[model samples]
Target chain A: MLAFRKVVEKMEGYVPGEQPQEKGFIKLNTNENPYPPPREVLKALQEKVTPERLALYPPPLSDQLRFKLSEVYGVPPDQIIVGNGSDELLNIIFRAFLGYRSRVAYLYPTYTLYRTLATIQEADYLEIPFQGEDFQQLPSRFLAEEADLKVVCNPNSPTGTFIPMEEIEKLLQSSRCPVVLDEAYVDFAEESALPLLPKYPHLIIVRTLSKSFSLAGLRIGFLFAHSEVVKGLLKLKDSYNVNILSQIAGVAALEGLNQVKENISKIKRTREWFSQALKSLGFQVLPSQANFVFVRSRSYESLEKVYQELKSRKILVRFFPEWKEWLRITIGKDQEMQILLENLKEILGKEWNQGA
Target chain B: MLAFRKVVEKMEGYVPGEQPQEKGFIKLNTNENPYPPPREVLKALQEKVTPERLALYPPPLSDQLRFKLSEVYGVPPDQIIVGNGSDELLNIIFRAFLGYRSRVAYLYPTYTLYRTLATIQEADYLEIPFQGEDFQQLPSRFLAEEADLKVVCNPNSPTGTFIPMEEIEKLLQSSRCPVVLDEAYVDFAEESALPLLPKYPHLIIVRTLSKSFSLAGLRIGFLFAHSEVVKGLLKLKDSYNVNILSQIAGVAALEGLNQVKENISKIKRTREWFSQALKSLGFQVLPSQANFVFVRSRSYESLEKVYQELKSRKILVRFFPEWKEWLRITIGKDQEMQILLENLKEILGKEWNQGA
Candidate 1:
């Protein structure tokens, strides 16, 4: 009786990082900021959500919010599109650009969600392995005209590796296909591809308020691109996709720029300190621009044992089974790092002297 | 430069009802509720939103919220699939069930979105028109095994008519297609088809928190069906489609059922009173079970005058140019309706004296 499509049945869904239900855990697992969003964002959202506003449909397109984003990105309103999240924006890219036979390219371990989206669209997924010492470079051949879409996750997830802007520019030369630079962590990174949107009509940069802005619960993100790409996405999206509250919250975040900057500074400082501490614990911490550190475990056996030990001790951190030898710890509050280090000390305390 | 598929180029997009920005006027253009959602809902939402929760990912599939909806609809966890909104769920249905050439059926003057979705998918649309005096009978003959899907919007939008459950049951008997009953306004109606999920595998009832639950600002809705349909939708949906805020807000709403019921009771009373007032003013209003009243504006001149007069006031209402003679007025608060009535009298002030 169940007639799920053959493609979907065979395909594995993308599993997002675990959101721990257990309380009293140092949840550095999913790279979520330990701090709340700017105070103004919450106040603005609370102030705007008059019970009456919820009765009506939210403004379709959130033109005011879009305009704010356009200002932030230094683009015209026509060149911007907002979504329930950047995930929603990405889905539209798949729907608008890719067809059943269309080929889409992305890195293997970048964001697992990309592959799942392509699979759902039933498009061909071109998994490119990261070869260079820095995982940022892609094959020139991957972005050939034959490929309809290519997604690059910069300040890449799980690994926290980055590609230089010049390397990305080189890949763009051969690509007539639309390039999606998912700069989800760009605010924390050195530069943004958003500034390059005017030069490359086919380039679409996905940005989110989930990370640096610390507003993950209020899902809001935007795609900065050419007018045509944004218009195409609008055609494919729900008329009232962004709810009234998110639009309000998103605009508030934009207006409260100084406050958001202060929060990001706090996270960046915490990230640096946490990274240095992990290195001292006999772990190799990847140079990171994002809010998390990826460390290769000293021993594969200890990695699993340490993960269980951390869980048992009620401190949560991300574990990638594929990268069985690595752990991704989010740059949480300063207090959370202390707890994680304490747990790590207990796990490696006995083995530390013998191994080191 | 503009490279979309032939199907994409041919797609005539879904144009939703007008969302006016201007203030001051008896703006009853769209089917929005006259009054705000319950106070308790807003309060609960306000109380739930803190800085830390906002920093974390919302429970993608909130079991607590889902279970509450389960209690309301009497379905198991596996049987219910919630989404950002019912629109997201509908999109998933099109992708999961229909192919480019697959046939689909829906009412002629139903929610126009259904037709647009079919067009976007490049599927054939079977737009069967309504007939009979009661608006309870449908063209059941349109139900064919070859068609992959069928949608029935109860108390149909624009027309403000409803198809009987018997007619829906007849449509279901064909077994040729998955019948989607979109009960967006089911909260204000007599009954819902959720109970039949146990017996009918292909029957899917799409309900929204937007209507009865009064969480439109929070885009959360659920599809109740046998586990098979849920699986099909899950396969097609973008992972993490529902944001965290919507999930938390939805749980708050369901748990606070007393508030929801009170809002519904008040809205229903307001709707009845407003319908009579419009009739007294020599206007024809459709017997609407939903939150809106669809009425025929007497003359193009008067309709034009009425729309402008309301616009001059700070009220925003929806007006359709497609069928210029008809206006769909949502039930606003009694104070708003009183102002609307007073404005209508002013519009007719000269007309009444002329006795035309």
Candidate 2:
């Protein structure tokens, strides 16, 4: 009586962060930009939603937006392929590379979507655990390219720790299979994998406007890779993968680069200050290159209580059961961060003291 | 140096109909709605582009849209899943069902995307060819449950012939695997396979806003199936597959069903008139239930010449090389169709007659 494939039936699938509809919650759970996109993005969106534009099909390949991204990344147009999101690109990569016989490897506690995608494809999943609390170094065997496809999320989520470019290059050099460098958070960090595209034929760098550009609702992402790799991916991509409104908004975000850069800088500065503030409150905060801070309270028991208390106060932050002691909090505006700190101090003082 | 899988490297990808950017041509190649979408759709788009909405993630799984679609289709909320486009839904289906050992079947000269998708998934393809000019029947063996997944495009594209519900039901009842009824153009046709969902748990109906709702540029599409089928698809879908603007525009389109129905009726009328007009000029035409006419001149050589003449007149209609004698002409507005008729008369008289 069962119609679905064995893999789909067995899989629980990826659960995204809860999107609470209850009003007045400080939403810091997902790593979305707290600030609104630039004014120009709205203007571009205004122009694209007209009757004439909505009636026609979008350009299949998103040529104009890809051209704009090319100039921004200083890459050839052939090397760029736009998708509905980097999420779609990840799906396409799996379809093109991994199969029943093939296997995929990703860092343990990385973007969980890769695992979900592999499960959907029914491919073998190899979890490569990072060393210690810093979660930086990978095992030598994991880097030897045992899997058909390998994914590394730079400035990894939940941990907010970035792997250095030198380490990535070393892995790419030794790896026999293609490597995907997911740079979804790289805009907040200093280095990008775009420069390494020409040198490493096997490298595919994925980026998104959901974070740095503050347009998560628009769903735009791009892949920077060698032309040959891009060609294979293009074959697997859905025609008209990117919607017209997203393309317009993406271009507008690119045009207003200075404004977006200012916002990123503000988030980074706030992240640093927020990290120091969390440390002062007797919490262990990981050094983050992304827009979010990953922190753990003084004790493991305190973590669950603090998260619940924060939720009761309508301040939402991400708590993963696997990482029981840790919490991933996105950097919001200064005012939001201030309220968070004040709330944290009150919650920690009352709850931790009572528990002790 | 070759990094892609064997299937990816060996297969020729799907090439969508040409999107001509040159102005003033009677742009009918891709079957896009010639008239603009309803005013309400634009209004919805305008409302959704706000800075605040753009900064956050769209409702994962598009809950609001599915609710609206539920009321319209008289199906429960769980039975519908929205996608970036039906194209994306197609991709998800391949990932969920088809695999290395699985096989897919689709009618020849139908929507070519199905074959391309199966190729991308590395699934074996069984292309069921229609007998003659009117592609009305599928081979009996194709109906037998040989393939893991079967696709039938109702009001079949390129040929524009509609199969009755009885045929669909018979196939569904006999199908050993899941059957996907792609009703991308079903709004223009008289009947759909929607009512069969309750009777056949294996039936999955895919519809798109690209054709009837005239929101192709927005990239909104939906799947109507049994709740169990929808559940399997939900697990495979990207968390935030549909963008905010598309969801808003889709809800608005649903709200403005009257306007969309009026547009569909008008296109149906134009299609009738245009089919007669083509027949008057000694051309062969299949009975079309969709928004376009599938036509071929009396002589095969004359068909290619007429296509070139139409292009010379800056009236672009789709000409599939594989279907060398045939041309798929999207029915535009009355005036546009009239202009197309006059131009066709002139081109057929001059170039096609001269070649004959």
Candidate 3:
């Protein structure tokens, strides 16, 4: 047998949300944006794809995109770094701060990929469970835990709940390690921790173009931090992390912010409408600041049956076995959600009649 | 001060060949293909770039490209893993086999990025010097050295020397650890070690589209190995490592092999003609199997002077301080090489007159 590293040999790989190969199913499991990216983004991609241009290596640090990001986000060019995705930035953070068996801490059930990265690095991690019923407040010990790195995914995944900026600042103030505030879904949320970067030297804010910008297929993300932190993280990233097409797509996506804002507003409206509709059917829906919602019903068995029936009927929504009775469903187009609600009512109604 | 890992704090980042931002230079520094990729590749990219397609995530493992690669190269689909570039594949290999303080072995003066990666991982490495004057043979102790991983760059960089397949097989036969055969430049060489995979489960061959296929800006690469090895490396890779446009570009590049072969043959012809031209000018040129030629002069000072003079004349070639008397020049189109030769003769004649 090949002698693979013990960490790699023993640890399970991070399984991303299933991307079904076959067509025609409503793909809501991965929380992908319901709308396509702005027309300008596609136009930019078309303009950039040429034989001569593709023959050269991309700019080492994606400087053009960084400059564009600096202009749009008000972050200094030196303070920003582009990555393959926020996933790559997270991996870089772990590699830069956490050596073998180094300590990392994050909230339990935020992004499972964090635990997988820690395991890959052979680093120890402390998962502090989020406090309160709606998963809003940070864990009491989160600020006090001593670790090399910490991660906070605002508008946390699978739950879609947001934490206030003040709470994030408190943790940043008290923590000695680099606190990564993952803002992957922050475009749809109330506020961002990016403004906190000036005050917190240890704060690393990561953003992605996948959600609100509707360029998930492009795999572009940004990390904003102090110049010193950015410099150190830069040492750990792949030399040509971002490709030419991605850099162009990112610039165009940022330029088309007006279109993105319209999409976000429509999704938010649909989210509220769908949440209330689910509540009418006697299911508890969390107030979400993300593109998706976390829904809980009265019975775990019935929820499982609902998940199975939805799958069979060609509606794809995320079902986490760890969070029993809870189903995370992405808010697609209004009409798609309407079809989903109609199908859900029939399934629940049939189950209720069977119970009677 | 924020605490970064000791390894990251002490390590220097890998400095890739300078990519000048300004235009209008001869541009032969980074070893990028002088010829543009096939028109079909760009057509494929244009066809793939749609607003709706850009909204969803790319296939996580680049399955379509892998299928195409398997069909073209006859490697089993399970044995092939696609990466952002062969550089990312190299990083994955380091992460998978060499944990913290684990040993990695490679030849000196091969790819400097190997050393940078070792430093980043905080792993110990043994650099065995290339044997003899021509660097056509592996180091004597290379096979016997105990290491967690070993890397061999066939048609090695900077030197442009090729080691025979028999020699590579000998190393593979003797080494107990995973042997990484980095064939980034192998497309320009005589033979490949790909057929040796069935006999040696520990052999991993890494190839790139950057050098030969001229998709350097797209960042597409492949790693062919045992299925088990691919599985372990997959655990360490980012979920969506290769983006959408790159996947399409790779598939189309493979389909356009006829055009690529014609380009490769032209480059080889230019490489030979350039080597002979430099030799006629009294510069010692290595017998190159790769797309570039390495030339050594009698004096390091004169070589430095030549490098500076060439830069002033708007021609760019790589000059490594460590390889004092030697300058590595990428073989460009015939007209570009003619211009370089014309300039070189003038500089040498001027220097000879001044010395006399």
Candidate 4:
């Protein structure tokens, strides 16, 4: 028998939101941008697909992308590192700081991939639950726990609830260990913890182009930190984590930020409208600062049935078993969201009329 | 102070071959394919750059690329896993099998990245040197050393010397532990250990499009192993390691194997010509099966002077500090090789006349 490390043997791989191969289904399960990236991004990609470009190795540290990100975000280029995706950045943090004897802490009902990564490293972790019902407040005990690494997914996934910047600062101030502020969905929100990077040398903010820039398929992500932290993480990263085309696409996406901003505005508007629509139908919808809304019905059984009904109708939304009564719905284009809303209303009304 | 893991603090990162920023140098430092990938690859990439594709998350495991590789390599689709590059695949293997308490072994003067990876994982590693000066035979002690994982870089880098499949089988037969046969440069060689995979369930064959397929910039690699091994490595890889463009490009490259085969034949032919040319110039060139030749001079001082002279003339080849008397030169286009040869002749002649 091939002897896999005990940790790998014991840990289950993270299941990303289902990406049905066949097209035409409403794909709100993964929170990808509902629109394409700016035309310039595609144009840049097309221009970059030459024989010479494809034959050479990419710039090892993605220097061009880092420079563009630095210019856009106001951080020095040396302090930033580009990754294959934000997932790679998160994994690097775990590998660099959290090991077998180290401990990691994150909020419960958050991005579950953190738990999977911590498990893979065989590190002890605390999945501290939110203190309140809205899933907005950080657990007080989470601040008190000592860990080698801490992660905060602002505008956290599955729930789409945003923790305030002040609250995130509190965590950064309380912990001396590395704090990975994953702002994968923060562009949809009002503020970012990127400003905290200079104040806290240990603050590593991870951002991806997937949700806001509409380049998820390109796999471009950035990590902003003190140069010292960046240097250490560089030691652990693959020599050329980001490929050539990705680096080119990332630069073009940043250059086309106006288009990305317009899309973010549209998604934000649709998120608000969708949240209100869900609430009007007697579902409790969390106030989302992301491109998705977390909704719950009063009954777990009925909510699960609604989930299945939506799936049957070829409209896919996210349903985590841990949050039995809650369903996470990504805000697609207005028309797609409208179709989803109509299906939800019919499913719930039919269930209510049946009185089962 | 931000406390990095002890392993990260102590370990120096892998320094990749120098990629000079400015153009116009006779670049042959890294062993990237001098030729461009097939035109079909660029066409596939261009066609894949639509907004809808960019907005969507790539298929998590790159199913299409895997299927294409399966068709070409005759391996089951389930047994093949694609990665950002073979570098990522190697990292996954090190993470899955070799950890803090485990041990790894690889040939000395092989790809040094393996040692760096083991060091990052804080695992003990044994660097078994090749038994002979020609670097054709594997060290006798390598088969005896019990390790959790053993890596063999076929047509090993820097030296470009290949171990025959039968010799590799001897190592596989003696060890029950996982053996990773990295065939990154194998397409340029005469044979691969892939055919042995069926007999040795523990054998993992890693191949990359970077060298032979001329898609290094696209970062596509394939790992072929038993489904059981693939399953374990999957747990450690990022959810979407290969981006959409890379996957599309990989499939197209595989489809255009005829072009790639022609390029490989050209590189091999160039390798032989360059080796013979170097030998005529009083340089000892290793019998190279890969696209690069390892050339050494009898005097370290004179070789160092020659390397500097080549660099001064805007010609770049690889000079490793560890191998002070040796220089690893990548075979470029026939014309590029001709230019490199001319420069070497001039430098050596000047030094001989100077008699210093």
Better of 1 and 4 by TM-score: 4
Enumerate the candidates' DockQ scores in order. Answer: 0.58, 0.75, 0.84, 0.85
In Å, residue B349's CA in model 4 sits off its true spot by 1.7
lDDT of 3 by residue, B1-356 (tens): 67898888878788788777788889888889999998789888778677867888889989989999999999999999999989999999998888778999999788889998988887899989988888888776998899999999888988899999999999999999999999999989999999999999999999999999998999998999999999989999999999988998899999899999999999999998889888999989988988888888764444766787899999999888777678899999999999999999998877753542
| Candidate 4 positional error at A276, Å | 0.7
Interface RMSD of 2: 1.3
Assess the local accuracy of residue B186 in candidate 1 as a C-alpha lDDT between 0 and 100: 80
TM-score of the second chain in candidate 3:
0.97
Screening candidate 2 with a backbone cut-off below 3 angstroms (N, C-alpha, C), the clashing residue pairs are: none
The numbered model that scores best in lDDT is 3
State the lDDT of candidate 2 residue by residue for A1-356, as single tens digits: 53567888889878899787567999999988988898899888777557877888888889889999999889999999998888989988988888775799888888888888887777899988887778777667677758899999998887888888888888889887999999999999889777788888999999999999998989999999888888888888888888888888899999988889999999989998889988988889988999998898765543766788889999999888777778899999999999999998898767564653
lDDT of 4 at B121: 82
lDDT of 1 by residue, B1-356 (tens): 54665566667567776676655445466666655565666777788778888788877677678988888767788888889888988888887776667778887767878877887777789877777644667765665535778888887887666766776777788755678899998878777776676778888889888877767667787888888667667866665677766777777777777877887888889889998998998888888888887776464433644665667775555566655666777876788888888877787775642432
The TM-score ranking, best first, is 4, 3, 2, 1
Please, what are the lDDT tens digits per residue for candidate 1 over residues A1-356? 64555666677666777777667777888878777777888898678878767767788888789988877868898888888888889888887777677778887678888877787666789887877655666665654536778889998987787777887776677678888899888788888776666778888888899898887877788888888777666788898889888888888888877877887788889889888988888888888888898887555443655777788888878887777778888888898898889879887876743442
Q: Comparing to the true complex, what docking class would candidate 4 get?
A: high
Ranking by DockQ: 4, 3, 2, 1
- Per-residue lDDT of candidate 4, residues B1-356 (tens digit): 58999989988999998777788888888998998898789888767668888888899889999998999989999999999999999999999998886899899898989989999888999999898887878777998889999999998998999998878999999898999999999988888998898999999999999999998898898899999889999999899888998988899999999999999999988988888888988888888888899888774443566677888888889888778778989889999999999998887766653553
